[model samples]
Target: MNWDTIQGNWKQFKGQAQQKWGDLTDDDLDKAEGNREELEGRIQEKYGRSKEEAKKEVDDFMSSL
Candidate 1:
């Protein structure tokens, strides 16, 4: 799915995200609030991944959904 569609359906995807990245807190996802940059940032922070890596992971995850 596209970024817009992902953002629009963020709530529905949160569970999957939590499952994929168990270290991410509920507050982190809340702060993301459907924004791709915010989600990427959270993924980076929680997973200790580089910015580009986080972005790529998020992209891959969204594509899978």
Candidate 2:
């Protein structure tokens, strides 16, 4: 699904996201609140990834689901 669909169904996807990015804290997910940009920022902070890298990772994650 696309980011908008994923955002709308964040509750369903939250656990999967946590599983994918184990370093991200619960509070980080809470703050993200289904915002792709926010989640990407959190991933970048926690994983020391470049913005493009994070976006690519997120895209891959979405595709896997």
Candidate 3:
């Protein structure tokens, strides 16, 4: 989904996001608040992944939903 769709559906999406990326805390999701860049950065930091890897992981997780 696009950023707008993700933002619009964040409440529902967050559960799935948590399941997919367990390292992400609720605060991280709240802080992200549908901002793709922030979410990517948090994922990268939490998972110790490169930017591309984090983006790919996020993309894969979202696509799976």
Q: Give all candidates' CA lDDT scores.
A: 0.88, 0.95, 0.88
Cα deviation of 46 in candidate 1 (Å)?
Answer: 1.3
What would the per-residue lDDT of candidate 3 be over residues 1-65, giving only the tens digit for each residue? Answer: 67689889999899988888898999999999888889999989998999999889878876887
In candidate 1 the C-alpha lDDT for residue 41 amounts to 91
Q: Which stretches of candidate 1 lie over 4 Å from their true place?
A: none
Tens digits of per-residue lDDT for model 2 on 1-65? 89899899998999999999999988999999999999999999999999999999999999999
Q: Output the worst ten-in-a-row residue range by lDDT, candidate 1.
A: 1-10
For residue 11, what is the lDDT in candidate 3? 90
Which has the greatest TM-score? Answer: 2
Estimate the overall C-alpha local distance difference test score of candidate 1. 0.88
lDDT of 1 by residue, 28-62 (tens): 88899889899899888878999999999988898
Which candidate number maximizes lDDT? 2
Q: Model 3: residues >4 Å from true position, as ranges?
A: none
Model 3 alpha-carbon miss at residue 11, Å = 0.8
